[model samples]
Target: MESLAPALGLGWDRQLGPSLPLSKVTVSAPEKDKWRRIEPTINTIWPIVEKADARAREFVARRRAATRAAA
Candidate 1:
């Protein structure tokens, strides 16, 4: 990230973001069972999730290429 910082014009001065914290909860569960309880709902929302994933991939690809060029 520091390597790409200059190319991307990011710095403390710009303060682009640290929007999401690098933290995670320990998800111990019969989470599969819990998820199965909502299987129908997940099926319904999965398409939207897929679309968002595709968009994010494209955005990241573009950003990487731009950073490479700037480098």
Candidate 2:
């Protein structure tokens, strides 16, 4: 899991800037069973998540450009 941190754009410390910590948690049996059902749904929708992230970044860039032009 630690190895996948970099792939997920996670950092070990806040030296570069602000960082959000992602840690593993111990789940109860019921919680684990629930995740077992939900995990596949998340996996299926991951592509949509990526697409939305790209769109958000593009929107931010366009907004910044418009702000600069206005200024």
Candidate 3:
């Protein structure tokens, strides 16, 4: 998932966003459940989660920064 950060950023930035030609697909419940179990065992998922969290925090910070800039 950490590998997905760049693509995710592109989507968020509207640079590589979802559109008719680039529609996103979701995983099935069973696959999702399997991934849930694999996350903790793999240890690789932790960085991904941290990166996502940091991204989210950065997004919030950006929003707040915009408000501050406006003020």
Candidate 4:
């Protein structure tokens, strides 16, 4: 299954090692404008967004830890 991933152009290996830290990326104001434009709408449902983000982070952390342990 792992061997088939590369042939399919599905780079699963990229997610296996240490995760990228968000702080390492530098985003310019223009790049962030899209989100800024939606700020009002996002604020209306901020709680839902926060909850989903937390769940996603938890999922990634568990997956990364499991992969490292296997390695």
Candidate 5:
């Protein structure tokens, strides 16, 4: 399986590719590398990052839904 990084698309900061990208790119760039970029991980933070990412995803999802509903 592949990571969601590819699905996030171009132009967003590689280091913080959203909690997720549900809309079209707000900015455009030619390079593809930026999309596959992941946060630089170190051994100690592996489990900690996983837990944080799970919460981030849930929070972002709810926020997106609320924003869409309000719009």
Candidate 6:
């Protein structure tokens, strides 16, 4: 059967169109206020974030090397 996901706007496969205009953006007080506490937690996690980024870079380097070898 043909997919209903695109018709229902549920899946990512469809390149439907540009997102709703910036003017249409929804502002949520709950979401905005929740991040106030998270800001300090993110600062505390800075070292962890740096390590994760370095690991990702190493993974990408390994993948590129393997791709070059296969080619």
Indicate the TM-score of model 6.
0.37
3 or 6, greater by lDDT: 6
Per-residue lDDT for 3-56 in model 2, tens only?
333433455552443554444573543334676667889889888798898987
Model 4, range 35-70, lDDT digits (tens) per residue? 887789989998878988998778667666666677
The TM-score values for the models, in the order shown, are: 0.43, 0.36, 0.34, 0.49, 0.38, 0.37
Better of 4 and 5 by lDDT: 4
How would you encode candidate 5's per-residue C-alpha lDDT over 1-71 as one tens digit per residue?
02243332223344654355544765654456764454354555678788898987886676656656776
Q: What tens-digit string does per-residue lDDT give for candidate 1 at 1-71?
A: 55455444575444446554534773654334767877999999998799898987787777778877877
Q: Report the lDDT of model 3 for residue 37.
A: 60
C-alpha RMSD values across all candidates: 7.3, 10.6, 8.1, 9.6, 12.6, 10.4
CA lDDT of each prediction against the hidden true structure: 0.68, 0.61, 0.56, 0.63, 0.56, 0.60
Q: Name the best candidate (by TM-score).
A: 4
Candidate 3: tens digits of C-alpha lDDT, residues 1-71: 22244323432333543433523564443334576566566686567588888988788677656656776
Worst 10 residues of 3 by lDDT: 5-14
The C-alpha local distance difference test score for the whole of candidate 3 amounts to 0.56
RMSD of 4: 9.6
Worst 10 residues of 1 by lDDT: 13-22
